[model samples]
Target: MIVSTNDGQFDQLIDDLSRLPTYTIGRATTNSIVVANGKISGQHARLIQCTPTCFIFEDLSSKNGSFVNEVRIARKVVDKQDTLRLADTTFDIDTLLALLKAEPVKAEKPVPPVSITPKLLSEVESNSLNFTEEFADLKQVYEQYPKLRKDCRNREKMIRTGSVILSSIVSISAVVSTGGAALPLLHVLSGAGLSVLIPTLCSTLLSTEEKLEVIDKEYRERYRCPNPACRDPFGTREWELLAQQKTCRRCQAIWVQ
Candidate 1:
């Protein structure tokens, strides 16, 4: 469906199709799209049909990956009629077609489909993408550790309060016995139940131990080696100092945290 071509011109040519189920832009002659432009790879990228009205633009991991507006994405879900860019090309999906063109692809080795999750709150919009990660060391030093400690205290307080109420019941039932064959037995049973229950409740109601949390926010934003290739965590926090200036233990990235 060679709707348009604008490999090089004053500006890009526009393809106004409503949606496209599947298509690719590549320099390879076998590719559905034959982009002869030198800027694009021989086998660049393609759009996979996820549903009748949904699609995923997948980068084939070329020298330069395809861009949704300007952001580079390995894979991302998109709704019908969305447009994207690869090198100098811009494409509009064609959803109005009754049946999309299908072909059986054979290869030396199979390429796995890229996993892309669509945003439910809003339709996929191009221009930019934001990702979040985590660092537990930063969380423990600055934020969550205080809250976790407070929770431990609250749980201990609840156990103490519950123990006092149960103790009162046990003391009354053990000493103040009503006289009768059933009454004495009932008192004994009540005392015995409390003896087992109070300890059980205190021990198992909630864990009093601190749990280790994992790193999760944007990993690069945390105190770590600034080198994009390194994963070494920045070491040795100065307890008396409040400033963020620090050095990476592995890559020696001397920068403010």
Candidate 2:
């Protein structure tokens, strides 16, 4: 069964309720019909399968309570025509059920059984060993940090040297060498100042330190997780917690750093 509502809150509310025999409508993450509101209880109301195709909704001693078609119901068998309300959102139960009935059911394709040979087993073992080696590379990723800093320093020095040399040449040509001819002193000084300003702007803006920092950040993100089996991205709440602990959410493997 598929259900869709115009409300942003119930965007992913559509699912096969038949497969989920008992659907709990609440703010809790564990609930099937998750309301995701502060007002609703953790395990608010329960929806039970009465028959093969029939469902019944029952209020589970909720603080806010549940209603059907504006009337507060303690327990009521769901009908296609019924309008259910929980918390702030007013669900059009009749329209949702109609859409569910109209929606076609897709049959799942059967997966073929794996027949592991000696060559395949050898490949699998090789992959497992390579995976561990890849994670070992994460530890050595920071070893390149010293080299990166040195390179950035060298590049900055080169830029500074180049800028100084260019500006010096321009200044000597325009100011020191008078060409033994009648030329305006203001024009010559202005030309030297303009030449120095261009090089100074280029050196300041195209900084090697900024470029090196960007590259370092990219690598840090790439090699965050030490365990290759649990190489989940390191930004989420679960991964953040894992940083303090020795457990990973992806592989459910306990590790020591």
Backbone steric clashes in candidate 1, count: 13
Q: Where does the lowest 10-residue lDDT sum fall in candidate 2?
A: 9-18
Question: Over the stretch 74-100, how does candidate 1's per-residue lDDT look in tens digits?
Answer: 766554445666776665555313223
lDDT on C-alpha atoms for all candidate structures:
0.41, 0.46
Query: Against the hidden reference, what TM-scores do the models get?
Result: 0.28, 0.29
Name the 10 consecutive residues with the lowest summed lDDT in model 1: 9-18
Steric clashes per prediction: 13, 0
Task: Assess candidate 1 and give its TM-score to the true structure.
Answer: 0.28
Q: Per-residue CA lDDT of candidate 2, range 106-136, in tens?
A: 9989999999999999998655423333443
